[model samples]
Each structure stands twice: as C-alpha cells, then as structure tokens.
Target: MYEQISHSLLNDILNRIKPDIYQKDLRHFYTRLGANFYAIHGLFAKLYGNREDFDLQAQRLVETMARQYIKREDELKQLDIERERDYNWFLNQKWVGMALYANGFADDLKDMQSHLSYFQELGVNMVHIMPIMECPEGQSDGGYAVSNFREIDNRVGSLEDLRSLSEEMRSRDMLLAMDVVLNHTSDEHEWAEKARTGDSTYLEYYYTFESRNIPDMFEQSMLEVFPETAPGNFTWDEKIQRWVMTVFNNYQWDLNYNNPAVFIEMLDVILYWANQGADILRLDAVAFLWKKLGSTCQNEHEAHLILQLLKDCCQVTAPGVLFIAEAIVAPSEVTKYFGEDAVIAKECEIAYNATFMALLWDAVATKNANLLNQGIKSLPNKLERATWLNYVRCHDDIGLGFDDKDIIQSGYEPQSHRRFLIDYLTGRFENSFARGLPFAENIKTGDSRISGSLASLVGLQYAIETGDVDAQENSVKLILLLHSMILSFGGIPLLYYGDEIGTLNDDTYLDDPDKMDDNRWVHRPNIDWGKAEKRHTPCTVEYDIFNGLKKMITIRKEINVFSDFNNRELVDVGNPNLFVFNRFNPQKFHDRVLVVTNFNDQPQKLDLEDVASWGTYKQGQLFDLHTRQKPEIFNNTLVIPSFSFYWLREM
Candidate 1:
C-alpha cells in the first residue's frame, strides 16, 4: 500500500501531527495510518485533488482520524483486534437481527434496556434501533433529518442512556446497530443556520447556487425521490436567496462531498459513533453521496470512491465497527454498494436485499414462485466477505423494483403486472384479502409502492375484521411461510418490530397531521405490551406468530450450512407454485438442507427424482427440520401442505 507520492504526503502529515497524539500511542496509530494512507490519499485526491490546500486537507484528514483513535476506549480497541483476527465473523449464521424504533418498542432508551430480555426471548441477537439523532420535531424524517450528529434526541434518551443500552446489549452478547445519516442534514442543523447567516466557509459545505441555471441543468437527469411530497431536487432558501440541493425533502439539505472539509468532518462523525459502541453503523442514503450534472445523481462512480475512502478511514481507527449500506437500488446496482472488490467488501460489509424482498411480495400476491425463482436467479452474487440483510418487511414502503426482463420471463407484462400488484395489495381487486395502502403513486408513470406491516398485507387485518377463523389460520400460516423463506435465504433475516406478534397496520398515524401524508407510518406501530402478553397464550394469533418466528430463529442459529458462503443452490422443480433451494456447509459436503416453500393454497408435490442429485432425496428418510417430523411422501414425491414450507434434511 506504500506509494511514493502518497507516502511522501503521509510522512509530511505524520511529522506535523501534534505531540500529544504522537506521544499517547504513536506506534499503534502510526502503523494503521501508514497502512491505510495510500487508499486514503488516492481517494481524497480523486475527490479534492484540484484544491489549492490539498496537502493541508490531507494533513487535516490524518489529524481527524488520530484524534478519534486517541479517544477510542481500550475495550473497543481490544474488540477491534478480535474482529481483525476473525474478519469473516459477521458472515456466520447465528446472527439474527430485528429493526425497531426505540420509542415505538418502548418508552425510551432506558425502557428499551429493561426489555432487552424481550429480544432474547425471541432469539434475536442483533438490534437495529432506528435513528435517534436530534432533529426538528415535525421536520424529522423518522429521525433521518439530523440537526445534531453527536446528541441523541431527548425524546428517545440522553447519550448516557444510549451508552447504558449498548453496554447492556453487549453484556447479553447482542450487536447494536444505529443509523448515521450520511447523505444530508436537517435544514435546522447548525451548519444550515450558519449558512443562512451568510457564512461563506460553512455555506460551501452544501450545494448552493445563486441562480437557477445550474439547478435547471441538473434537474434534467435527476429523478424526483418523493414526487408526491417533495417534488424537486433543489429547494429555494429564502434566507440565503439561493437554491440548495434537497434530494429528500425541503428540510433536508444535501452535503457537498466535493468539499474536502465536509468529507473529513463526516469521517470524524462515523468514528465518533463507533467509539460509542455501535457495532454496526447503517450509512443512510449512501448512493446519493456524489452528484454529477448529466447523471441521475445516484450510484455515481464518485459515490463508490467516497464509501471506499470512508471504509479505509474507519479501518484505521475503529476496525471492529461494520457498515450496512442503505442503498436500496436495483439488484444489479445493489451489490456494488458492497464494492467491486472480489473478496473484500471495501465499501460496506452488509446491504439490504431489496430485490429479494420485493420478489417475495410478488410471489405472495400471484400465488406462484415463477417470478421469485427467476428474479432470484438474475440477482448478482455478492462479494465473498459481505452478506445480506434479508427481511419480509421494514420501516419503509416496498417498491416493486424488479427487472422487466425477469417479469417477462415469468410470463407477466411488466407494466400491467405492477398495476395488478398495487390493486391486489390495496384490496381493490375482488377476493383480495390484503389491507395495504398505495404509497407515493406517480400519476404520470403509473408507478407506485406498497406500505403496510407484514401481518396486514398478508391478510391478518382483513381476517380479524371479518372474524373468519379459517381465514385467520391461513393468514398465520402465510406469515410463517414468508418468514421461512427469509430465514433460509442465506443471509441475516431481519425481523421488523411488532411483526413477531402479527401486529397490524396502525391507522392511528392517519390522525396525525405530520404523519398523515406518509402511509409508511402505518406499519410503524407502537408495540402494546398488553397485547404482546397474548403471545404466550396458546391458539392466539399472537402466540402462533411469536412462537413460530422464535422457533425459526432458534433453528437458524444451529445450522452452520445456513451461513452465507455462496452455498445456496436454487432448484427448478417444474411446479410453478413451489420455490425450492438447497443450503450446504461448504466445508462439509454431507451437511445439507433442502428448503421447499409452497405458495399455493392447496397441497403441492415436488418429485424426488428431479432432485436425486441433491444427495439422498431419492432413498434416505427425510425429516422436516421445522416440524421435526417426517414429511408425507407418496409415489416418489414430497407433499407440501397448503401455505406451508419445509426444511428437509436427510436422516
């Protein structure tokens, strides 16, 4: 990693390092800096090399990393060493995550700590607390608009309370994941306030223009992220008499990575949170980091470089902290967030498998696996060191971002099929049991997204409304079936908060003026402890879902073959209603499990002769790992009951 020009610049930067930093732990700091300097220098140069103070900025970057390294606690440093020794530790199958809003789950961070045992009871070892950063009360995009990066929102808890929560989770051997909004900051942020006051230095930290000439040019290629709510990419700031890039909303201003100072500052913020015990930092809106005039201003090449630089910088200080790329793009572009490297994830260690998630929804609505199987086959293989964050649902609206070619291959017209899904899920179609709302419907393009909790979208809400016991039973089975796929889907299955007990869409958000416009808030229900208690009551919907998910998590943790080391093999069983795949431990050929899911409401059969190559399906007795019983077999075939799944292992 030592290059002549970059290392020469590194030596210059190191010599100018303050005596206090040099005397504290110079050996350790210097070694890490030296190793990562080449990539850092190259990336920084790519971003801000044309500047007059390029060398000075490089010096500042090194100083920023050094200060953070000096403040990093001994325990954290020890963790860094341990993780370095086992670089691929995160790819293990034992890690199951649950994403939740702290306040929604409990009263506050302190109350959340008290309920850590709740997560333990559900067999969840990783907790992703949605953004708790300070923001303007009404303008906060569910905590995405950050007014202060260092302070935890008082409504959630103080920094001390968060620290206590992290400590408690660590004690219970649970990983803590928090959000760091890397793309933009709230207009109420101190930097924005300074810019409003006409501070030139701070004004340069964001993308601002005095006229509409450049803004109009950029708009030609830029797609509106929230067309229904926040229409344009740039917002005119009345205070400054200028237009600023506001990709998400008017209250959120995009930072200028073209400025080296901004890059160095954000890097410092990342390391700061890592020191606060965030084992994983979900970098928000990473694909929008860099903007170009003639491009969509997303997934730009420079954006990838920025992530690579950020990862390299973090490695120098807090090597143990991993990054989850929150870029929910197409399947082709999603894997790039893990970086282009073959064996190493230079950008992020984990990414959201949005394609797989959307495809699963397709299977649910069509009652077939044709699209799911074909769509998954088209998904590009991820990097070796990286893994996926698979989920049935999350806190965001689900967009049908499948490839048109894959849809055609599955025998569906792209445009009409998407419309069918929207209609079916919104309950506009006759006999459709789903209770979902159409989110961000684009009138011009006829494109829309679906927003609702898994339980509601899968018919639990409708079943309860009609008081249909049979419908209720089928809904519960479908819920378990969807989870079965994600659990065995070769990644970390992320359970959304409240989904464990079949919590329904909370229409209460419709009553709030601020939340009424965003239907995604419907799924962000506040957990009712009173209702949650019913999870222990036999035959209740709560009991069926909670215990069912807990059972899956328990089984998933015990299977080494489930680890995501490129061991999944999709099987085409000729039955369009069934989706089948095999998971195996790469190190042991004999250790394998065949996962078969029936999307039909009637019994479906998979011929054992077609899967004889899977080793033992032809002759040996097979047991369902989920039920711990032999599957019903007849005439050289396995019968999967209505809306059911099986984890078949040869015994």
Candidate 2:
C-alpha cells in the first residue's frame, strides 16, 4: 500500500494539498489515501497517462477525495468504520429493498417521509428512490437526464427535503438508495449549453466532431439504443455546427470520460450524494461509459477501469456507501460489473440479475421450468463479496436477454423463442392472459421488450376485467411464486413499488404527449391511495398479495440460510414442471431449506429420493415455511400444487 513510487507521489500531493483541505484533521484521510493511492495511481495513469496534464489530474483527484472526506459527517465516518469491521454486512438476509419513483410513490420527498411507516409495515428495510435530480421538464428522460448534479428536482422537493427523508429513514433503521446518472447529461445542462456557445474548454467535455467521417466509422459498429425514436448514436448539434455522441437520445449528450475533468466532476457528484445520507448509489448507464470505433461500444475494458477508480476513490471518502451496477447486459457480462476478482468485488458490490428475472417470466408464460432451469444453470457465479439485486419488475421493460446456447439446450430456436415471448406477453398469442405492450420494437431484427406492471403481465389485469375468480386465484399464486424465487435465490430481493398491492398497468400515460411515445411509462403508474387501502381488507386481491409478500419478507429475514454467501445449490430433480434449489448455511450443512416451485397449471410431483443428495430431503418431516403445514408426501413423492412454491425445512 505504501510502495516507494506511489507513496513518493502521495507525499508530494499531500504537501501541496489546498489550504481548505489541509485545514481539516486529515489523519484518517491520509491513512486511507495512502492505502488506496497505488491502485488509484495505476488506474488514473491507464485512463489518462498520455495527457500533458496527467500529473495535474492525479493531484486534482487526490484533492477531490480530501474535499469530500472533509465534508463527510462525523456520524457517517463512524458508520464507515463499523461497515469496514463487518465487510460482509450488506450480504445479510435482513436487507430487503423496494425501488420506487419519489413523486409516484407519494407526493414528494416530504410526503414520502410521512409514509415511512408504510415501508416498515411491509418489512422493507431498504428503499431505492429512483432519479429525482434536476432536469428539464419534458426532456428529463424520466429524470435520468440531469441539468444539475447537486440539486433535487423542484417537483420532488428541495435538497433539504431529501436530506430530511434520508435522515428519517436512517433514524428508523432503514437504508436510502439514490441514483447518480454517470454516463450523460441533458443537452440543456450548463456544460452542454457552454459547448453550444463555442466554449473550447466545455467543448472538450463531450464527444464532438466537426465532420461526419468519424461518426460514420463509429456508427458502423455501434448499435442504435433507441432506433425507433432517436435512430442513431450521433446527433448533429445545429448551434455548435458539429456532431455529438447521443447514444440514448438526441437531447442526452454523452460525457467524454477521456477527459479527467469529467471524471473528477462526476466523483464530486457521487460524494455529494453520499454525504446526503445515501447508503447505496445506483450508477446508471455504466456499461456505455467508454467508447471505441471498432467495437460495439459496450462493456469495454476502459469502462471497467473508470468504475474501479471510482470505487477506490469512494472507499477513501465514504466506505459506508455501496454501488449497484445498473448494467443489464448478457448473463456472462453482467457478472463482470461485479468485477473480475474471484472472491471480492473491486467495482460494484451489487448488480441486477436481469437474466434470472427474464427466466422467471419465461416459466410464467410457458407454464413450465424447462427454460428457467437451463438459463439459470448457464448464469455465471458472482464473487463472494458481491451480490445480486433480484426483482420481478422494475421501471424498465422486460428484456429476454437469455443466452442462445441455453435456448438451444431448452429445445427452442433462440430467435423464434424471443419472438414467442414478445407475442405471448403482448397478448398476440392464443390463450395468453398477459396484457403487456411492446416497447422499443426494432423493425430490422423483429426484437422488442415487454412493458406492463407485474400484475398486468402475470394475468391479474385480465382476470379482474373478466371477473373470473379461478383466473384471479391463479394470478395471485403466480405473483407469490415468482417473488418466492427472488426472495430465496441467493441475493437481495428488490420489490417494485406497486407489485405488492397488484397495481395494474396505467393507461394514463397514453394521454400525455411526452409520455405516449414510451410504453415503459405504462408500468410507471401513480399510486392510488383509494385502491391501496384494500390491502387491509381480507380476501381482496390487494389483501392477498400485500399480506402474502409481507409474510415472505418476514420469513426471509429470519432465515440465516437465505443470506447470500454462494451457498445456493441448483438441484436437478429430473422434473421439468418443478424448478428446485437448496439454500443452506455454509457453516452448518444440516440447516437447509429446499425450495420447490411448480410452474404448471396442474399439480406436479417430485420424488424425494431423486433429491436425496440434498440430505434433508431424504428422510425427514418437512414443512412449508410459508404455510407452516406439513407437505403432502405419498410413497416418497412430494406434491407441489399448481402455480405455487414451497420453502421446505425439516420440522
């Protein structure tokens, strides 16, 4: 940590530290900076070594970390020490999270603070309030396009209000997660505005070119992220008389990480949020951080280096804060966001389990686990210190990003199977109960994603519309079954805001001109307090789902075996209708729970002898953790009811 060359550079930087930073206690800062400066120096060099101002940039990076450390609250510093002592604190089973839009969930930050009791009632200890940063009204990209890095949107209340909400959450023993859009900024942002006015310094902040030659070359390999809407990766800036890389949309200008100034500025933004009491910061659009001409411009090595540098810098400033990688790439590439380290995560501590989420949807539509079983088997194992943020639904559309090999092994053509899923969820297929809409449909590849609330996509909307009691019951069972998988599937289970009360897809966005173009808004509904009240009324759809999920959350927190320690073992039970796995405390093999789910419309039986290798399934009295009832076992075969799951443990 204190290598000669690195420490010599550190000593020089420390002596030249600005008066404001040197005025602070800085003992802790010096120790941490010394420990991490070697890696930081190496990464910063790799990213900007060729620049004339490389040494100046390194000095600025160290100064930025010192400034943030000076601003970090005393209480937060104590929390950092505590978290360092228990490095695996976040991997515990007690941290269940819910992702929601601040304005949609309640009125704003203050109103959301008033409803903290609602979160506690549902047993949710962590809450990820989606992007609420300042942005242009109509061009906000659902709040991802930021106009200001330090201010909260006026619609979502002031920064003081957000601080109050975070403080309240912390007092109640809850964690607050916020989003930091790392990749780009709204065209109306001050930086972009300056570039528009021919400020040479600001012009270098973004990817701008005078001619179309380089843009054309890059377009040859760059895939259009919004082909239906934006069409290409480069947008011609009329005022600037040049082209700028706008990978997401025309109004969202991508930042040039090639500029060390950009990296330093973004690091300041991350630390500012951490000081505001964010326990977790969701890094948005991380995979597209760096771009090259000859490649697809995603998951590039430089992007990883940027993230590693960011993590190391944050560790010195706010070690209590964790990062959730928002990269929803291929199954193989998704784990890379957790970093290449075999036992520890050098980048992000958590990532979205997009493949597993898609696989669960496949089982729901097919009424079988053939693809779900195979796809999960293909998912690479993540690092021990890193975990997954597993969920059934989020603000985004459901993408079937399954590996082609797994699809072939499951006896389906990859292209046709993907088409089938789009058709099935969009209600274009026969006997389909789903009421989802197709989002981002690509005419060239016939590829698209599904958009709708969990309740609507899983048949609750249609069942309620037709007033079919049997269909309604089946939908409720399907909802609980999907949740059971995420809750016990070796990660932190994230519940989408409206899923607990069976909130249906909202068509209100259809009337708004700004929102009509994006069907993802269909699932991002405003909570109806009148309907949410039904959650307390017995036998209602809301009551069934809310209470059912509450029980699972309670059970999950009590089960130490559910903690993610790479202890999950996928069991091949030789039954296609049943998806089975085992969860056990790695230290105590005898303490285990066998999770079994029947993805069929009819009862499925699993022979206990087939899973005898799991030990507890061989010869013991077992009970369902949810129902607390003895499972029906006849002739050494266990029967799983249709559209249901069991978390079985020896009684």
Candidate 3:
C-alpha cells in the first residue's frame, strides 16, 4: 500500500499538520494515517491530482482528520478499540434493522427517544433514521437535498435531540443509522448560495459550467433519473449565468468530487456525523459519485476508489462507525460496493439488498416463486466481511431491475414480463387487488416503477375495503410470508416504519401541493397512534400483523443460522408455486432450518422425496417456527396453504 509517489505527497501534507494536532495525544492518529495514507493519497490523486492546488488540498485533508479526532469523545475512542477487537460483530445474525423517518415514526427526534420501547418490542436492534439533516422545507426531496450537513432539520428537532436519541439507542444496545447525502447539496446550502452569488471558489464545489457545450456531451450518455418530472440533468442558473448538473432535481445541485476541496469538505461532514454518535452512516447516491463523459456516469471506477479512501480514513478516526453503501444497481455491480477483496469489505460494510426486495415483490404479484428462485441464484455472493440490508419495503419506489437472462430463464420475455409486473401491481391486470401507482414512467422506453405500501400492494387495502374476510386473511398471510423470507434471508432484515401493523397507503399526499407530485409519499405516512393502539386489541387487522411480525422477530434473533455467512442454499423444488431455501450452520450441519413458501391461492404440497437429504421425522413432525404448530402432512408430504410460508424445523 505504501507507494513512493503517494507517500511522498502524504509526507508533504504531514509536514503542514498544525502544531495543535500534535499538542494532544495522537499516537493512534499517526499510526492510522501512516497505514492508510498510501490508498488515500492514491485515490485523492486519481480524483483531483490535475488541479493546480493539489498540494494545498492534500494538506487540508490531513488537517480535517486531525481536527475531527481531537474533538471526538473519549468514550467513542474507547468504543473504536472495542469494535476493533471484535471486527466481525456487525455480521451477527441478531442484528435486525428497521428504517423509518424520524418525523413519520414519531413527532421528532425527542419523541423518537421515547419510542425506544416500541423498537425493543419488535426486536429491532438497528434503526435507520432516514435523512434527518436540514433541508429546504418544500424542496427537501425527502431530506436528500441537504441544506446543511451539520444541522438536523428543524422539523425533526435540533442536533441535541438527535444526539440524545443516539445516546438512548446506544444504551438500549441498538445501533443508530443516519444518512449523509454525499452526492448533492440543496441549492440553498451555504456553499451553493455563495456560488449563486458569483463566488468562483464556491462554484468549484459543484458541477458548474459557463456554457452548454460540455453539458451536452455529458448528457449524451447520462440517463435522466427523473426524466418526466425533472426533465434534464443540467439546469440553467440565471443568477450565475451558468449551468449546474442537477441529477436528482434542479434544486439539488450535484457536487463535483473531481475537486479535492469538495472531497475534503464531504469527508469533514462524514466525520462530523460520526462524532454525533451515529453508529452507521448510510452514504446516499454513492454510485454516481464520480462522473465521466461517454459513460452512464454510474458505478465508475473512481467512485469505488473514493469509497475505499473514505473507509480507510474513517477507520483512522472512528473505527466503530460503519458505512452502508446505498447503491441499488444491477446484481453484477451490487457486490462490488462491498469491494473486490476476498475477505475485507474495503468499500462499505453494508449495502441494500434491492435485488432481493424486487424479486420478493415479483413473487407476490405472480403468486409463484419461479423468478425469486432464479433471480436469487444469479445474485452475486457478497464479500466475507460485508452484509446485506434486506427489507420488504422502504421509503422509495420499487424498480424491477432484474437481469434479462434471469427473466428468460424463468420462462418470460424480458420486456413483456416487466410490463406485466407494472400492470399487476398497479391493478391494471385482471383479478389484481393491488392499489399501487406508477412512478418515473418513461414514454420513450415504456418502463416505470411501482409505489405503494406493502399492505396495499398485497391486497390488504382492497380486502379490508370490500369487507371480504377470506381475502383479508389471505392478505395477512402474504404480509407475514414476505417478512419470513427477509428474516431468514442471509442478512440484517430491515422493516419499514408502518409495515409491522399493516398501515395502508395515505392518499392525503394528493392534497399537499408540495408532496402531490411524488407518489412515493403515499407509502411514507405519519404513524397513526390511535390505529396503532389496535395492535393491543387482538381481533383487529392491526393486531394480527403486529403480533405476527413481533413473534417472527423474536424467533429470528434466537436463530444463529440466519447470520450473513453465505450459509444459505437455494432448493429447487420443481414446483412453481413453492420457493424453498435452507439456512444451516456449516460448523454444525444438524443445526438447520428449512424455509418453504407457497405463493399460490391453493394448497401446494412439497414432495418429501426431493429433500430426503435434509432428513426428517417424516412430515408429521415438521413444525412451523412462526406459528409454533405442526402443519398438515399426508403420504410423507407437507402441505402449505394459500399465500403462506413456513420456517420448518424438525421437533
């Protein structure tokens, strides 16, 4: 790692390190800086070496880490040592996660502190507070267009409230996950504001150009993320008489990582959050970090180098703090976010399993597991140290970004199959009970994503509305079936805020002019405490889902085989209605659990002859872990009912 050119540059930067950096105890700083400087310098050079002020930028980078380290709490420093000792602690099976907006889940960060008991009741030990950073009230982009990296949004309470919440979570043995929007900044952000006011230095912080010539070249290969709503990738700034790259929205200006000053500033923002007691920092839009002409401007090679350098620098300052790469790209590229190393997760310790989420939804709409089995089999294996953030739903629209080969292998034409899924989930297909909406519809490509709450998409909304008891019960089964897969799937299962109690889509967003444009807001609703109270009332719909998920989480934490160790085996049962897999402890093969899911409306039998190698006390002895009861078995075969799943263990 110690290359002469990079080391010599690092040596020059270390020479400029303020005397104050050495005034305190920095033995650990010197050790880590020396260990990581090679990669850091290499990545920094690759990103911004051509700039005239490269030497000055490198000096500021060293100073930034030194200053942050000095301000870091002693208790946190001790935590870093403890985590360094137990490097594999994050890969544990017990770490079940739940993602929620601070305001949606509770009133604010302070109120969220009081709701710790609710999280504990659901057996959640990792909570991701989605984008609490300060942003323009109406142009927030769900808090992604951060106006200030150091401040928590006023709507979500103050920074003190966030710190208190993090402390409370830490005391409860839970991890606090926060977001740092690394790719873009709100135009209202101080730097962007100054750039708008004719500050050339501040303009360098973003991708700004005086003319459309270069923008036209970049737009040739860059895909518009919001083609229908936002239109183009570049937005003309009349004030500055220039064009700025606005990949997400016109108000959200993309930062230029090619500028070392931008890199150093973002690094400081990252360390600032780490000091705020965030155990895990989710890096947003990391795939689009480094942009290049004549390319899609995603998953760039320099992007990976930037992440590697960030990981290395974080290890020096806050070793306990982790990074979750929020890259929802193809299966072939998703694993690279975990890094290319055989053992070490050089880029990120965690990433969203968007593929698994999409594949699960495919199974739900089709009432079959043919695609789920085929898709997962094609999913690339993760690195030894990295883990997945598996979830049934999140605060975004669902894209059916499955590989074409996998679609064909599952006996469906790629384009037609995708169109069928969109139609089915949006209730355009016959007998489809889903009440979802279309998102990001592109007329040119005939492609679009779906947006709806988990309960609504699974027919619970339609069932309850029509007063059909049988359909309602089937909806509940479908909800639990989806949860079972994520729970036992090889990673930390992330539950969305309202999914546990079957919260329906909130159509109120259509009334709010600020939110009416985005359909994803339908699924991101405020928690109704009055309706949530019904979970304690037993016979209600809320009680069924709440209790079912509560029971499943409790059992999941107790199973060690559910850990993310690549110990899962996909079982081809030869029945399209059934999706099967096994989770076993390789060290002790006898400690195993067989997961079987029946997606059809009719009873589906699993032939015992095919899985005889699993060994069993016949079908009668098989018990469902979620329901805690023996299922019906006849002629050495087990029968799973309509829209149901079972985590069977021989008792």
Best by lDDT: 2
What is the lDDT ranking, best to worst?
2, 1, 3
- Model 3 residue 297 CA deviation in Å: 0.6
| Model 1 bad stretches (over 4 Å) | 615-620
Off by over 4 Å in 3: 1-12
**In model 1, which range of ten residues has the least summed lDDT?**
611-620
Per-residue lDDT tens digits for candidate 1, residues 146-265, read 999999999999999998888888889999999999999999999999999999999998999999999999999999999999998999999999999999999999999999889988
Clashing pairs in 1: none
Worst 10 residues of 2 by lDDT: 612-621
Clashes of each: 0, 0, 0
Candidate 1's C-alpha lDDT? 0.92
Encode model 2's per-residue lDDT on 1-651: one tens digit a residue: 446777788888888888988988988878888789899988998999899998788899999899889999898999899999999999999999999999999999999998899999999999999999999989578999999999999998999998888888889999999999999999999999999999999998999999999999999999988789889999998999999999999999999999999999999999999999999999999999998999998999999999999999999999889999999999989999999998989999999999999999999988999999999999999999999999999999999999999999999999999999999999899999999999889988999999999999989999999998898999999999999999999999999999999999999998998888988999998999888899999999999999999999999999999999999999999999999999988788679999999999999999888887654343348888988888888877899999999899986
Clashing pairs in 2: none
RMSD of 1: 1.2
Q: Please give each candidate's TM-score.
A: 0.99, 0.99, 0.97
